[model samples]
Target: MAGLRVDFGLLLEPLGFIKVLEWIFSIFVFATCGSFQGETTLVVSCKGVVNKTVTAAFAYPFRLNTVAFSAPDPEGCGGAWTDIYLVGNFSSSAQFFVTLAVLVFLYCIAALGVYIGYKHVYQQNSKFPLTDLAITVITAFLWMVGTFAWAKALANIKMATGASMIPGIETCKAPGITCRLASVTSMKTLNVSVVFGLLNMILWAGNIWFIYKDTNLFNKSNIISQSPAMYSARRI
Candidate 1:
């Protein structure tokens, strides 16, 4: 009689799809700036907050009240009297890039761990190390989503200050201003971050399970060490 053959494709399909999803989402995250629309809506709809109201106040007496201004206010405006710097609210392209870079690095490590675990199981034609598998998958998901959040936050800043479409809008015209100047406008990012944090917690839980197995079960038991006997026992 012919022996049965296992379908490795069935087992590996999901992992491959997840990897592809990561790549697609990464391009969107990195390129789209997270699609953040500016707070012009809020500042316009809400009372008491108009053009010059959202100022970027710098250290000691330097302050740029609006994007229209080319220089800071006169209050001891610091000597030099050189080039003027405009101040405007803009998105966080640099921060988004940095955060996304870190996220990608972490996920690459997680993916490598998963690949190693899968290889170990397949080489012996044995069951996968479920704990390791879960940990790596969960870590990848969290890191991916977190990177998305940071990207969107920066995109939002771009949206708000009308910098999402740069060059058309003057760059560095806004002085001493970094991306994301308002908190009310970042609620979407905050929600995404919360979900990402929860996923991270789940990843940590999986790591704990792995530690428990290594410390209390793997070291003391002869499960894998006597695999042939164990398999025979299962047949009877």
Candidate 2:
């Protein structure tokens, strides 16, 4: 017959909270990118010496598909444009996939850990595994890579759009219409995506710290329990 079970508080630690937060951030970044459909438009104005004026338009739109994607920013004047927006869109899509992988891993590990801990709490001699620490380290690196990709994408978009907006003087390529950029505007979810991405990166750093601290405390307790003095003290 078994007596009262020992107080294995480690099995009831707050590690699950971090796991929950991890999933939340991952889903948040994904959703922000998904529901976001943004476009950039540049309106060009041209004036002829005969007191007549004409206008041209250039638009860059982003599109994503479940099986494939493309980056197209065509101009009305048939001139090829910069590919910054393309790169930015690709980066966002990649980040979404990476975040999804991380979310799945977090859910699995958290569930397994909770289940194992629950079983151990009943004195079944079960033990928590160190796999989570490795997972954290791996995901941290992935997060970093994803973060860099996002930064590059955003930078490229800004540069491309700004450069394209500078519609310098142009001769009448078309019969009587000369065109120059009048105004440029971008409407996209890049702002929200960027904000969420930054916060996600910061949260990842915190998660690493929390895991280190918790594991350190756990290891120290084990070491103390194995100490000769402590064992003797317990005997007395």
Candidate 3:
């Protein structure tokens, strides 16, 4: 009779795919200026509560304060030499990049752990026992936290700034600016981010279960090897 064969591919393949997904989404999150060569639909539309006036404040890349000529004011001030960006814009932009860095770091560590698992390499180092389990657990926890904060982190700004799921006619918001949006706006980044966050939760959950199974398999194999040795000693 033929014996069964064990292949670690079942475990590693999914992890690889997960890494790919995370990498792609990380680009969207880290795209501070725009996704396509300095072009994006991300902007703030502000409306005055009293005057019902609107202003369109476009998003710019993160940078230190620079003294520059004022942009032509919507109030028709013909532009002035003033500081750029509002309070909300700077805060949100900074946070998005920070979150991107954290997620990318976690994803890299997870990739390394997956490599060690499939290759069965460096597994004997007791310096840090069960490193794979640690990686899986930490990654899952981070994913959980990220998903929980999905609303506040990514959704709030997109939604607040006139993000629409409908095919036509989108809107955006800012403190005192509003305008009729004519550009074909897109929210691909926010959509992908939400989807990625959900999948990450499921994949990490499966990873934890797989690690438990692997550990038991290892213990059983060790016992099976010792059984033949003990029998031979008795026969001697």
Candidate 4:
């Protein structure tokens, strides 16, 4: 009859403590990247009319190309320009990053529950530690892939929405119509998200060593190498 027994001491161990950090960092990774909403304004100066400020807004799961803003009115610009959209289709990378973070967050919660409440059962069962190690390794790899993709996507998003894009806009190229970027929402939080993502990867990768120690493989190797007599005695 193995019932849940809370063990507060596990919180001090590397396995328990690192899981806590992974849980917290996972939240940060998703909150900063998933909840992000940004806007960029393009100031359109045209002959014979007041300068028009066109605002383009974008948000999480950013599919920038899908986010269109009305081009400066043809009547106002003295020229025709269709709706302009931010560049790039970054949804795949963005969604992958956020989805991984959310899944990792949930995993951390469940892992912590196991660490705190079922510590004894977990230790007595080699399968639990082995599974934990394998999952940790996979998660670390995913974090690395997701973080890099998201970071690259973020850079592209900045370029697509910034002043550099002015030259690419047809209306901006029209004679007597000058366009300049007014402002773009700061991506500082998204940058932090990337940082947290990297940290999560490092933490999980490092935690692998600690988790592996609890696995039967590590114990068997130690018994064979460090105490061959004890190993043979156990076999006999």
TM-score of each: 0.32, 0.55, 0.48, 0.92
Q: What lDDT tens digits, residue by residue, belong to model 4 across residues 7-40? A: 8788899999999999999999999999999999
Of 2 and 3, the candidate ranking higher by lDDT: 2
For model 2, which pairs clash?
Answer: none
Comparing 1 with 3 on TM-score, the higher-scoring candidate is 3
- Which digits, one per residue and each the tens of the lDDT, describe model 2 over residues 1-236? 13433343543455555565566666666565544444333333223132222322222223211211121223423442222221224545445544554574566465545544453432232233345556667766767666666656655655544445334323324344443333334525555556656666666566666565545456677787789887798999
Q: Compose the digit string of candidate 3's lDDT tens values, residues 1-236.
A: 12233344533465555555555545554452234121112232333122232233333332212212123335432221123321223344445443744666566555545444534442333223256557667767766676556535444445333434212222223224343323333556545655666566566667676554445456677889999999999999
Candidate 1 matches the true fold with a TM-score of 0.32
lDDT of 1 by residue, 1-236 (tens): 12334343523554444443444444444333333332321111112222222332221111222323223224212332223233433334334443553465466455445444444443333234445445455655655555555445444443434434223333323443222223233335434433444444344434444434433345446667788898898999
Kindly report which residue stretches of model 4 are placed more than 4 angstroms away from their true locations once superposed: 71-79, 228-236
List RMSD in Å for every model shown. Answer: 12.0, 8.0, 10.0, 2.9
Sorted by lDDT (best first), the order is 4, 2, 3, 1
* Between candidates 1 and 2, the lDDT winner: 2
lDDT of 4: 0.89
Shift of residue 81 alpha carbon in model 4, Å: 2.8
Quote model 3's TM-score. 0.48
- The top-ranked prediction according to lDDT is 4
In model 3, which runs have C-alpha deviations exceeding 4 angstroms? Answer: 1-129, 163-184, 216-236
